[model samples]
Target: MKKKKLLLTTALVGTMAFGATIPTSLAHDALGSDVNKGEERIVFSNEDLKTLESSLLKGRKNVGNFYEAAAVQIQELEGVQNNTADVYAHNGYAYLGTHTANGGNGGVRVFDLKDPSNPVEIAVFAHDVPYTWQEKVIVKSVNTPHFKGDLAAVSVQQTSRNNSSRPDSVGGVLLYDVTDPTDPQKLGFYQLDRRITGTHELYLTTQGNRALVLASSPYADYYTHGENEDFQIIDVSDPSNPEKLWGSDPRELEEISEKFNGYHWDAPDGHTRPVFNHSVITDNNGQYAYVSMWDLGTVIFDIQDPENPVYLGRTEYRDDQKGAAHSAALARGGNILIETREVSNPVGDGYEDAYGYTRILDIKDKTNPVLLSEFTTELTYDIPETSQGRTTFAKTVHDPKVHGNTLYLSYYSGGVIMVDITNPNNPTEIGRYTPESANVWGVFVDRNYVLASDMGQGLKVLARGNKVVNNGKGR
Candidate 1:
């Protein structure tokens, strides 16, 4: 009676620092989510942090969704390393991570994913903006967009890679009122006076008492240094009070698209757009706000009055903005905007559905966004060109979750994908639950549970029904 094996795909051998070298781009999934039998998942890897480090150092206290209780491992106080602690969810209980690990100098790692496979790390929003006395600079942002009725808007921009401190690039904008995710108290943080660096990515509009936050830093400086940005609008109708007002940064999108109206521009092309850190798809009643912008492609905003937002224009596909139109969706109250391409995918044949497709534009003429047609993914995998697709892992469809009409995509190694836009131009991939744990970066469905975010396997809660479906009590 012994079966709990979860060493995944190639038996994850990455512990970093313990003899160095673990990068072939992270030796594929590094032991996480290669699941098959019974299939209810969990793999918070590092071998479940080495079998839960003696039950997380015997501290207990695990409750989530907001004010993330506590468990330490604070990514070594915001310098994360090794297989690290990759966790991010926004609905399966509001969370986001990267206080360290994947990007050397990083910030922002919070949680409260209440029982979404145990998420509880309450507070530590140190992007460091002291400035005056100790001269502070590091406040890096990796997309902290949360709004399930409360507040938590984060998107810092300052990267000459960190260049050991400063080579230019710093726009550490931060705002929080998480209603109290273990006390997130920091009503404001805006340090973008242009020495470089700008808003990373945010798309929250909020109503009632009002809120704005649109932010964008498409890549702050074009190529590497930072500054091709444009996505600035912060008027936090007082979540403790924060205000920036107007915003725009579009250095003509670093100019790499020789052509983008008839197709024919592909060079490591995640399809030209690369400025908006991650996403901004709204419209399930959020009024209508879809802004992707990297190589410059998806920008359709009109947030009723979420504060002066009226850019109603953009949809200029592939002039080669260099892979950053990343992820987007507006499915439900549909006008169309389901874009993809976190890293461009078209390795033909070997059948991988050419990398989780999604391109359906035509935002009912918000200036102009009409590409209507391009979606072909139903779990196609064959990878074996010497594993050029690299050990063939999947789950980087990179964040996309909508419910009413169904969109749910987290595909880092390509798993958690379940489109069914009730026909948003034939987008019907339908039912799925494939968590063999590739790098499924962030997702949250709630009501029926789905809470994903299993990079090294940290937050994976399936819960639907049948095969032992009780979610307890209902048992």
Candidate 2:
């Protein structure tokens, strides 16, 4: 990987755009973080988009406690040439994924973070496959059968609703050799049939020498194919040649659907939707894979044997309950599971009173899962929720990540929230950062900084202010 030289120019403040120079003069204390104090390439520039600047100015005026100027705003990266989605930092490099924005192509942007304040973009990766929408990227080192070194996995989703429209429309996972951050070599591209909705979200784990990728195909379901799609697991032991290890049993669709009230269907876009897998994660030891099925609750799959996966147990929700089982993470030594729902559809009361928060499930027993509690931010009550098709960005819980006793979440427009889940029964919000023009898609709390990807803006680098206990978890 090669590093790029840093440049400096004047910036207007929270503006959005692709690739530009920002001077140190724009670095103000009001933004909450300390500027590097020298000529450097600021990751973000306000001069690019005046709207973003206005939003930041407004956000600063009425900042809340959790978001109150505690964390330092290290850097902001806008005009990255793509709409940022999920973000991952590894080996001094930040791999930022992209979403399908305005029919633009999706890919990943690699930034050299050796100099956090002056991060530089060294590479952009996109596959040559058709209907290829790369939204998420996961990187890890693999010592598999024939592969050993740094490997990156990215998701490929449907380019259009109908895969047949593009005969070569392929959707699945793409593996890459990212040993060198500047260059990502394609290892393998996995594709499912046109009938299935491609990979939406996924997770990667290493067991022994083989690498496993748990892919979430959220569009494949019983109503469409007469069977719900099981999250797929692939063995990338051989980076050049990947093989399907196992998948959820389609036969168990009706059984699980019945448990989740037979799939909560709502297609405001006029397209009849089906049940699907949204996210998949495994325990640290690779023993259990927690799969979150939208509207179907969470399903536990025993993956002790890489080649074989067995159904363990699942969570149950009620009809009157507001549920959108979207994604989850394991914590407390895999004894506790933190699940997040992705919905803001109004119920009887109206969008203003919609419910979409994080749920804590107890998986102490593999056979029976129990819901322990739920966590929500004050912003949920302050923001006005709207219908699914409407702009409910800041009203819903997008994702949750646990590091020690703290829970870092990315709320669409709510910015990034930090919660203290020390007590499983009572999760409290200790800190939060909601940008004025917030439209946060994903968040990752790194060793030295908190990384957030905003759909409307771009990447935000923040420091957990002195108010945070630091408890040595973020390291």
lDDT of each: 0.45, 0.62
What number of backbone clashes does candidate 2 have, counting pairs of residues 3 or more apart or in separate chains? 16
TM-score of 1: 0.29
Top lDDT model: 2
Q: For each candidate, what TM-score against the reference?
A: 0.29, 0.77
Distance (Å) between predicted and true CA of 379, model 1? 1.6
Candidate 2 structure quality by residue, lDDT tens digits, 125-192: 75466655677888888887688889999987765745556887767788898999898888788777
**Residue 469, candidate 1: alpha-carbon lDDT:** 21
Window of ten residues with lowest summed lDDT in model 2: 29-38
